[model samples]
Target: MEDSHSSTVYKCHLLNGEHVYLKIPYSNVKFHRELEAYELLKGRVSIPELLDYWSGDEECPGAFLLSELKGQSLTREVSPTVAYHVGVIHASMHAIQPPSSKRLNGIQNEFSNWSAFIEKQFYSFAEDVKEVLEEGLFNQSVEKFKKMNQQLPSPDGPSFVHMDFRPANIIIDGNKVSGIIDFESVRFGSTEVDFTKLYRDFLSADTTLYQAYKEGYNSIRPLIDLDVVLSFYRFIDAFNSIGWCKRRGIEKNTVFLEENTVRLKEFLR
Candidate 1:
């Protein structure tokens, strides 16, 4: 598969011609994070089954196996009902309480608190973008980043958030959401953090779709005040993406680089 996150995926077939996916992640840490996500969400969420695990060799770093999810990638626009169900599914994910730390005072878990995690993430990315960004825009980005706290509402809880939740990771069959794939970026954070990608990719395009999604989310849990905090989260997302493109490759990530560049400018203004 042409992976967006630099992970390699292969569609392997069984003797019965049933398909399974072998995923060799770019790093061991990413592999472990995906493993943790699958183990945690196995029975609760509509995710693929973890079948096998591979230790690193000189040739490959780390890998895992996943059962096939029966659905097409939701790349294009979907119906409001499908969007609603997706909203519900995402809510179920956020409802999960994840571990912030394994042992007492062993390591300061960034996921323990939303505000602190976000602030730490923001500054760390700030150092990366400083190298790639021009002086004026960089200054503007920082100024805008600093002001985000005043606008954002206090997060309800440090919930498990699929940080990369978007249309491409979603699977659909007819009008129903069959499953979601790609769990490498799962983390404990403000539930509000999860909505940024979905909004930018799909929900923001139509009012009715966004409203229906809100209704579905509310059915499972009370919807946060998205209107109050989306811009704040979106700006942070853009800044962090710019940093990613810098580290990965500017030429290869042109679309993402450009999109996030425009996002930063728009938010800064």
Candidate 2:
């Protein structure tokens, strides 16, 4: 299948004519993390059934996995009502409290506490484009981001966050949600962080879409100081996305980056 992101994904038919989704991770760590999260949440959520996972090293350089699912992505066609159900699904996932033993230090701490991991694994990406990054527009954007991140509120409780929740990650069939794919970014974080992607990226800021989502979400659980959490995530997301685009040599996404930055600044004010 055609993929928009770095990861390559394909649809293959099995001997029984069953459809399976295959994802080949670009990095070893990401591939392992995807498998870890899949194993952890397999029976708990409406994820595709995993058939197998294989890890390959220098000779192969990555990992690949097979999973079965039965619908197109919700990003293909979304409406206010669809946004509402998406909210419901996200809320449900957050309700599943992970065992204390399973929780790792969050992404925020990963950069600090996991510095060794960062050095061994992630630093290459940054080092590769350090020259481009230093002379780029992103240098100023990063400085502004530090200021915006300071306005975020502390998390109230730890919850299972999809970390990449968005219409593109959801699969739909007719009027119903068939499945959710891509658990690679799964983490234990403020549940509100997950909702930020939906509210800011997927829903188009349409009040009707926002209300529908809120209605479905409130039907399940009460959100605590939700506006504060949304604001926090909005700022952080814009900040992180800008850095990500910079590292990838992406300039067109600057428009989206600037738009969210403005929205976050306004909300904070």
Candidate 3:
């Protein structure tokens, strides 16, 4: 299973001084995901082109080589116009229908129904997070979701979604998006789930960016209504992050663990 950690990306300069990236992925599953995602999204989106890959054995991490997308990672330092471009790129990703084989490869994203998928995320990850979180917090969160379940909208389409669509995944060259990176979490699922990280990390802090993002997305495609299920999805995102840290290593993720704990508590309230 691919965890929360990304592959190590190494920049290599050719004799001519041009560069490519040598990526040593965290898991074989991630290697498969990057390879498949790069292959499927070629020319469809601004992604690094994959050059070669290795499935790797238990003793060694899976790895890959790919072309580099030269630009800065689109972090908090972004403008509304750039956010709009990111929105367009994201909407395009959601418009795709990944093959069943690729869908099944993402073990966590195999569910066809978004509601069931969210339920399973809570049920399975809840056990892993119980020890890591404060006492009774898990139960409280479960009850909260149970109540919200009654109000959740119908299942969104099983479209391809960038599972980790945050600013860090977006690359900006001037006002436009040069490329997007890290497709290891690509999956076919509800598009609303993709909004959580981007909203929490960037758009939530700036209304102009959020509005422009929506406008850009709507210009390319009609979202059923992100507002309706955003809270539900966002809560799931926070809850899952807590467990992800616990499973990956609490010691190494103190800041992330603390932030997610705060988010989880806020959501419960």
Candidate 4:
């Protein structure tokens, strides 16, 4: 079991020849979010079943166990067939609207206006963005962000979204996606945010896998104005990554951020 940035994962062997993944989260929010999200999406998707969790006392802290999913991560290579299967799974996840009757103690992303939301999200890392950009450049980026937000489509109604849906989180078994792990960033929000990684890699590559993914996702729920949404989110995601790099001291590897900033500047024109 590999260690995630926010948690330590351990493969534990239990009695009756069953193995389970024990995850110890550094933050209570991550632990509870995963627990609640898994509870909400147990049978609905191809995910490792949450077996049990312990909100440990003062001595223990927090821990959870999930039935070990059997598959290899598609980090290196994801065939077109597997990518299509992943798209199908992701579509299913997006299809599951959060039930009004139930409330999980999870992250809520309810925003009244998309413009305000974008501004707030960006300004949350205002200092960090300023750190990497000059005063004029920062103001220019903010102006572009505001203009883009104004043209965004109306709310598409809240839907379940894995904020970090990428190749590393997808598990493959032969030609199909067997498991989708790492639900800590899961939330109910704009469907556009979920397409960030896919658009960045698959869309840019224009590979058969991306075509299969587009076909499969459209087969379930059509991605109306996907290119437009991806365009806006590409900038938003860049701002986020730049902030992350600043926070984590990885400013040297923000080549994508530079490219995204150039695109955002062009979008303003």
Candidate 5:
């Protein structure tokens, strides 16, 4: 049976009629990363408790895991209050300072110097935009971003960042968030990266949500040069999305490419 989102989710009945979520991964590597992240963060944060994971077979290298989630996704129901709470949750996650040894591979190195880190990781993306996208408007926007990148502010500090912080990854029940899922993209970077997704994708130019998120973040840790950090990641994210869509052979992402190009132009200005 298909869920509302058309994802093939299985229900495993546990003791007392409780059910565990068994999500089948699309590929072996994705399964491995998802399971690895679940193991890394099971007891460390408010995530669905992971029970067990197993690979399907040699011919079919995909895998599945049993997890317990107490709430539904917040993407279906979003409001100003939910947005505020999402910000609070995001801030709390970033405040969790894991040991250096515990950090992810690329993230650990980046924590030492975020400016160089972003430049190193995203410079290739800029090149991809130049090569793959032949549109004059997009090319102009990319060039403008390259020049504007010199003026962006540097990171003030390193924090635990949920690189894919968005409504689909957050689970809510009643008025409280029950779980935050999908940590495969977790990294040690500026929290502003996470905030940018919330602000741009979720709030739709609503400054109130941005303010609420900022208040929540400031309550936990102060932000310095946040606008610059947000702008940098926003550009990188735009580039990454276009690259990803191309790699996945998704033609529909042309719209996203155009949208992000315009957004990058505005941010550069």
Candidate 6:
């Protein structure tokens, strides 16, 4: 089966012809992190059961795994109910507090406080666009982000968050969410971080779905200052992405940077 990005996934069939996904990662570090995440999340969430994993020798220097998960990637037909169910599952995942030893969140500690982490991340990335961005606009954005960061209170809890939770990552069997794949980006962080995709991307695009998700989440674990938190992290993510594109010299992502900038500004307001 052809999955996305740097993974080599093979649909390996057994003697009975039953198949399991064998995932091999390009980096040993990523391989170990993902293996740990799967081990941590097993039976807690609707995810693929980790069948086997091998941390190869120095000669090979990589890792691979076999696992089984039922259902396919969600295509076009996502209704409000599906969105709501996704929200509920997401909340359940967030409720789980992982061990402190887990350095899971993608960010590698630039700042002490999580809120400061958000501001520092955006400012660091916004620096990449200094030459391209107008001086006044850039300064204005900086001030706004600073103010927003100042107002951010301590996070309620640090929970296990699937940093890349989206439609493509979720698997559905009929109306039920059978499993969520792609644990490489899994981490422990503010629960608000998990809502960025749903609120900023999915919910913003569909009001009915947004309402249903809100209802579902509130029924399980209601979020406080949702709009503010969503905006805060959305802005941080946009700027971080912009910085990454700039740093990597990926000109193709210019449009993406611009779009995120606009969204970043909206959230800043």
* TM-score to true structure, per model: 0.91, 0.74, 0.90, 0.84, 0.76, 0.78
Better of 5 and 6 by TM-score: 6
**Which pairs of residues collide in model 6?**
none
Candidate 2 per-residue lDDT over residues 120-225, each given as its tens digit: 3323434433443334444454455446455656553456677778777888776667778776666655665676777666565577877777777777666556
Candidate 4 is scored at a TM of: 0.84
Q: Model 2, poorest ten-residue lDDT window?
A: 106-115
lDDT of 6 at 94: 78
Measured on C-alpha atoms, candidate 6 has an lDDT of 0.69
lDDT of 4 by residue, 66-85 (tens): 88777877643666777778
- Candidate 1 per-residue lDDT over residues 1-269, each given as its tens digit: 76556788998989998999999887766777787788778889899888998877877878988888888877446788987898899888888885545432211234556677788888888888898889999998888777777667767666778889988798888888888888776777678888999999888898888988898898888889988888888999999999988888888998988899898888877
lDDT winner among the candidates? 1
Better structure of 4 and 6 per TM-score: 4
Could you tell which candidate, 3 or 4, scores higher by TM-score?
3
Which ten residues in a row are the worst by lDDT in model 1? 101-110
Q: Return the clash pairs for model 4, or none.
A: none
Per-model CA lDDT versus the true structure: 0.82, 0.61, 0.80, 0.74, 0.64, 0.69
Better of 2 and 6 by TM-score: 6
lDDT per residue (tens digit) for residues 1-269 in model 3:
12226567778989998989888877777677777787778888889878887778887667888887878777767788988898899888877775656444533454366777678778888888888876799888888878887798766667777789887778899889988888877777778778888889888898998888888888878866878988988888888888888887889888888998999898887
Descending-lDDT candidate ranking: 1, 3, 4, 6, 5, 2
In angstroms, how far off is 123's CA in candidate 5? 3.3
lDDT of candidate 5 vs native?
Answer: 0.64
**TM-score-best of 1 and 6:** 1
